[model samples]
Target: MKRGWCFLLLWLLTPAWALAAELTGVRSRADAGNVRLVLDLSAPVKYKIFSLKNPYRLVVDIESTHTSKALSMPTTGMVKSVRAGKQQGGDLRVVFDLSSQVTPTSFLLKPQGAAGDRLVLDLGASTTPVKATTRSAGHQPQSKPKPQRSVVTRSVRDQPQRSVVIVIDPGHGGVDPGARGKNGVREKDVVLGISKELARLINKQPGMRAVLTRSDDRFIELSARRRMASKQHADLFLSIHANSFTNSKVRGSAVYALSQKGASSAAARALADKENAADLLGGVDLRGKPDLIKSVLMDLSQNATQESSLALAEKVLNGLSGVNKIHRNHVQTAGFVVLKSTSVPSVLVETAFISNPGEEKVLGSKKGQRKLASAIFKGVQDFVELDMALRLANAPSRPEISYEVRPGDTLSQVAQRYQVSLSRLRSVNSLRGDRLLVGKKLRIPTVAGI
Candidate 1:
């Protein structure tokens, strides 16, 4: 009787001894702008998820969980690959390598019928929805539900528009401590201080959002910095840096835009060469890319982008003149790798010369940083206002009417009938002469008053 009772007690305690959750399988799917990852487990597990930059990645750590074998899942959307491994104390760790930054959310699903305990992760852009899969698990086979809702919510008439996004980058971080001043002030630290102040001021303004490439002391690749701005759909990309010179006497601030041809001056060429060399220290591999590919990439800077960059640079330079000495009266042009963004208007602002003794003191002080930040913020405000005004002016205020020419209709007759000037009608229709072709459609300009 005693032996039978001891055996029953041992059997009852077996489950308590083996309480670790087992990860069974993993699966992933992706839609237009979002990705969904599901993890099947034997029991509910405590887990945490976080994001890491510098070649963006998402990490999932599950406590008191173990996987019998390596876990692998297909990559989709922003995710480039998935990796799983065991951590200290037998915890399961899964990592997702991503091509771009994403907003991540996770939740645990209770067991229901045939479905076991599961964890689901949703990754997507900020403006897109991620709860589509979570809310309708039973309707996975149907495609109509998600698209109809997405279309309706995205319509301009239904929802309010998003604000303009501005990405600010602080140059030189981590092991690569850019030019140091005599007082032991680092360029990276100074620029970060100024960038943070600028971001703070920008956030207080209405209809403007600010994003920093690196909010902390982390090293980010030059190419990845620009990619971040593009992924965020940024309207403006501003890189903040403290300048240095061989002559410690050089003191002033300057602004630069990307130049397709060459540097604007000899000094600008030397500075560009110096800044471009930072890639080597940051561990950027250019060996895989061919010369032809590099040439093609350089040619991607379109005329419209260049013009906008120069306009922004000029405004920023003008603002800097009020706070500090102007190094170059005009906006300088350089082949800066950071300013090579094809779509977003990009500019590099040299806040002040860190090598100069007097300027270094100002760059390192909090009050001076605030002043510099205010100047840059004012410049951005000016640029945004001017850009908005230009867009409004270029946009058609009234609807244009198309009129088909009749057998006896003349250009002046049509203009008179439409209550518009003949010259305005000719210009709107791109007419070279007074003659009008029959059966041809002419666009009539809607003049307020004739």
Candidate 2:
């Protein structure tokens, strides 16, 4: 009763401008082509934006507002630093120091579910892509004929087969640091390290390449991450994140595929809520934000894609189980915003628990991080092999090679030597086990490779 009376007195005595508006949160997101800065406020207000040169800076001034001391000041991607302070004339001033010149755009967003009013500012690279500077003396660069056969001919024959593209996203960047461990192990940094390692492994594998949604410690909206994967024509969209909880004892790896229905369990629902709240923290209001969400029409094509995502999630979960303790023996189902691609098969992987002291140490080390990455790569490789086998079964018969099993050779070794999936090799040879007797003849499928 005493605390309540004090609060009432304070509220009554406070100035209207200070009580009516507040600069509650400030965060930034690095998009594929630009960076977005959002200011969370208690109420909407008229704002002003201006630019500065000489080392490049952007200044935002909001009239009649107070700010939270905990308001985030992000330094990621090209953003050098951010600072918020009171301006003369009783205005709130937020300044962004930039690494280079950038164009700024601003918008006002009304309150959304579980979120309040926000002011959004977008920064784009001021310097555009440079074109060819040197030109031939005779003329500008001439266009080659479509059917040209010259050495410089732009043709499919000159292009090697495109490798399978896998887009790896390191979750919770920019303003959202994700869950923090007792020892200050940040989920964003740890997952970025793991994602980079996984990309390296994936690139080293023959006939595969990797693209990272974010290559540095920065924030990216979930929608932007998904759009990037789709734009790259990715075969797989694998989002990497580290889990955390109040109970440090809860720890392990988990895999999730998006569910059309509600989450499979209560915990899954709660986890989804935490993840979906990322946009709010980053200052992105999903309500009336059409640019972030393209469409919600789940057609037959999307259904087929979701099915494939689930199958791949299962394979990845199996692979994760081999390297680390499985949080769930089966692939969990959740409505993760990151896994909402209409064409790409997507999954979210919780590499480990950052909140757990033991797991945090393991994830902090390079060796342990690589081990986790390798485990994820194995799962992805399995999914790719299974997908290829399905395609091969439907594809017209390709030429086959026959080889006799050499002495001391195992089926797994043979599969590796031929650069083919173990499952496909087993299917073609009709082998039930890894054991192979000497001099056994096998029909090798050339579908995976020649």
Candidate 3:
């Protein structure tokens, strides 16, 4: 009886992490000089990978994971052979013998549709011999090779600026096919077509890149769409959607920014409620999402971000005016879940009322989609240029020294004494006249490093 009690105590004291995750299967695909290996998992697991020299092998160690007996290995391409063994402390180690020295890239993907959690590893042949290096899961191994200098030289002023990333989201898909028109045109189909065209146009411009939340007909949660924009460090977030009304006569385009203090109008409030219900229709549970409410509250304090969003909405509204009838001449505000991003300026563009037969036909046609995409692109271009100008104007330059004017001091004298241009000094101080009043502060700009 005492031995039985002791066994029970030992079992109860064991840690929950002692339970292992199962590595269900292994699959591989081979190309000309590269090989891709996919490991199917019953649950997500922590992993580490490293290269081995002198026989050239790659080792992968997954923590608290056990390999299934049916797991298979590949024998072709960069990988010559594969072996699996148990490591200390309930870890599984898989080693790959390579035919040649290779660089490895890896990433973990969450479960989607019929697939489970997956760990993907890609091995590519390297020209030079590789040094053994260790890396955590989903990270590329760092190379020790020194960077080479460019053959051509250029001035610092000639360097290109960083590209602005814009995240485009097409609303509703899959089971939740948004609004439908009399002609059988679905909102999902129309907005996706327009979003793709917008992405194409934005990519063609210099110093701008576009990323889509969903390129296909997949339903993404409203909060997830905003999170995607934040993940991309996006400068702007545009949610493309087609509006619908109970009355088929209502037809026009509209732009909206998020407002924490209720909607601007009754129609805007109803639309926001309809849009927010998409999560429930798409089977997304919002019960445990306190972060969503927190994000909305946080956005309320972000006045600069809200102002930028309003400015962006105005520009997009102006652009829409050129393509179709304006639903509202001014930009509207509502409590849209997708526009609650705290950092990125976000807006939702109602392309047109899908319920209207006349606009539905235009939305379904290729020519109409292109025209709308072009208008939105033009608006985005205008906003980006204006934003860039404001940033440049506000950017810190050469330091300035505060000088109080004396009885006989002149503006030109201060400019000359500081070795700064008189015009630049006048511009910096916003002085319309050159006369300096005694006892008044004068900002004298100084050259950097002088």
Candidate 4:
């Protein structure tokens, strides 16, 4: 963490374009289950949106905005999913399309700090045959199906769409204080607070849900975290952590991916070792399993998912840069144990440095945490939007990378063969060990660390 003065100075030096821009409208539509966003801004806003290979998500960045009203988000026809709010002091959005072909509508309302202005929209109802989209214009169409709501005559599964499940992992809790600041603030607490906030925001949206790896203050094995996401059949995973440095003069946010074997830094490998060690805390044995097999599988899996993850990570990095300095402008890849969930796209977010006294105090503050969490939420939304756009525009799905299960194939051996870390392989394929079933299929996650 850097001094308060540095933050102040950075703010002073920021390009005037970023400081004064404001978000106005962001309308979305669904076409064949794909969602497309058209942002109506007061001015030409310069922004970027991409995905991170780890903790896969879509991220968006905009100059700034003062949203003071309830935003109009439709859940009707083409719009089967929607999420919108403030993040990092800017307008945040999250949306899911049951199919492509969406129509967008937008309007603005006056400012009201607490409730904000009312941006009203009616998502005409999806053209798909889902029960929720069957309502006629005679009645106010329900945005989505809530717990208390009744199911229409149509069955949800009949619509034929994949559910998107997101798992949130809050870093450093219980016995691990993680990084501690001179002001006595703990990184664990700050990240937990932000995670909870993000979960709350995600839960409020339709077609999206969140699960926390550890809901309470307790220690959890890193392997278990990945397993949790696998058990939940999650679509994405996110690990949250606060950073620290020997000198209390550095501050910024960062995101990381899994490293390819021989491509990871020594520091990243060490961190991976520590994180993987958490699995041993639960007493998982590893006396010579198929390490190479697991590695090969991850390489194949990542071949299909890496592009999206990288895009999302880049978007997040850009979005975070809008709110604060970035530890690294590019997305980094390492052998992080927590990110070893092979099925779900995963990423680790280092929110800020706790070693800096000023940053520590700010992070401990409710306002600071809220701001940080908001930025992240918005970045995720942006990533989602980009994905929807690609789908609607007929963008190609990632090509699946494949690996063969050879006789006597071990996880480590396979990993070494593919030049990917063993943990990374296990994560992508949801493998318990180096054990391989002959003639089985596997998805490899990474070819090298970036």
Q: How much lDDT does each candidate structure score?
A: 0.74, 0.72, 0.75, 0.57
Give, for candidate 2, the lowest lDDT window spanning 10 residues.
148-157
Clashing residue pairs in candidate 1 (N, C-alpha, C atoms within 3 angstroms): none
Please provide, for model 1 over 76-179, each residue's C-alpha lDDT reduced to its tens digit, 9 standing for 90 to 100: 88888876755545567777888876667666676778988887777776544222111222222222223223311111111223345679999989877888
Return whichever of 2 and 4 wins on lDDT: 2
The TM-score leader among the candidates is 3
> What tens-digit string does per-residue lDDT give for candidate 4 at 210-316?
67777667777665677667655566678888878787998888887666553245645555555445444455543244473265244513544665565567666
How does each model score on TM-score? Answer: 0.51, 0.51, 0.52, 0.51
For candidate 4, give the lDDT of residue 376.
80
Deviation from native of the Cα of residue 270 in model 4, angstroms: 5.4
Tens digits of per-residue lDDT, candidate 2, 186-258, equal 8888898999899889868766667788877677887888777765556688999888888999989998888
lDDT of 3 at 268: 92
lDDT: worst 10-residue window of model 3: 147-156
Tens digits of lDDT, candidate 3, 17-42: 45677788888889887788888887
Clash totals, every prediction? 0, 3, 0, 80
User: What does the lDDT read for residue 145 in candidate 1?
Assistant: 23
Candidate 3: clashing residue pairs, number: 0
TM-score of 4: 0.51
Q: Best candidate, lDDT-wise?
A: 3
CA shift at 412, candidate 3, in angstroms?
62
